[model samples]
Target: MPKPGKHINHKGRNRRFTNPEELEEERRKEEEAKRWRQKRGEVSSEEEEEEDDEASGGSDSEDESSDDEEGKKAKGVSNLIEIENPNRVQKKNKKLTTLTVDVPPEKPQLSRREREEIEKQRAQAHYQKLHAEGKTDQARADLARLAIIKQQREEAQKRREADKKAKEDAVKAKTAQTQKALGKK
Candidate 1:
């Protein structure tokens, strides 16, 4: 093969890359070095320190105001205790009389769709039970009535859809004619 084409070694060039796992390890070491550089008081900005101080100061002010209010309330309760009669302490220790307010039972509310579904389920179960009890004639009659009702509902729905579509078509035609007359189409 013509002296191995000048004996050039491609494997020696790839030795720098060696294994795929070594590449991953090198990447992890780079990330760890960057994190340590950041931790050595070299990465945090002054604006971030200012934001931290502002947040801490806001919470401290809120806590001081709450402590002052609590102290004032405690002083007021102490004054009240000093002004009260000592002989009536037993009466004060007794629980205060509470008035019980009677409330009326709330009426349960059901949506129209929920009520319809519940009624439909109850009717289906009743019909199935009747059929299972060998009431074949009654079951057949109920099924026929249900079929008639379903057909009537489907016919009404179709009529409504047709009417709506016709209305929409008429509006679209009118708009198109107007646009054509205006020379905008």
Candidate 2:
């Protein structure tokens, strides 16, 4: 804030603003003893110390001694203080090991022809594997079962043929009997 310029009255006398409370306090003190105790500041403690040193004409040794004695640090300045360029990124150490694996790319979608080919290959491979493991080899019990199934199929076919032949013979015999009756009439 800008300090107020020195005020000049019509009487050419300089005037300065003073606190009424302070004036009253001074008056009370003067009334008590006609005296007692006095006043102080804009310069900080550090600046004040520097001014004191300049005023005292003190030696370097005395300055050093004062510095050693006045080791009291300002409260919590360390926490508030920040290092320069805190937002700057730091370079990483190259010596550290890094793992990079080259994974296989995703399998492409197969077309209809390709899918059919793959299915055929899988069936052939499975058939070969079953034969190689002797799993496709028919056991004696399985052979007997197959033979019984064949025998049953053959018997059924023979029965169907016999029934068809019997139907044809009946049809032929009925036609012949009808022709003979017509001839007699």
Best by lDDT: 1
Candidate 2 lDDT over 1-185, as tens digits, reads: 45567653478667788899999998787545421211222224554455456667666646764674466344557647865787999897764347445768789999999999999999999987876665775544566788999999999999999999999999998988998989963
Query: Which number leads on TM-score?
Result: 1
| Colliding residue pairs in candidate 1 | none
> Where is the poorest 10-residue window by lDDT in model 2?
34-43
Listed per model in order, the count of residue pairs whose N, CA or C atoms clash below 3 Å is 0, 0
Candidate 1 ranges beyond 4 A from true positions: 1-128, 132-135
C-alpha RMSD (angstroms) for model 1: 35.8
lDDT per prediction?
Answer: 0.72, 0.70
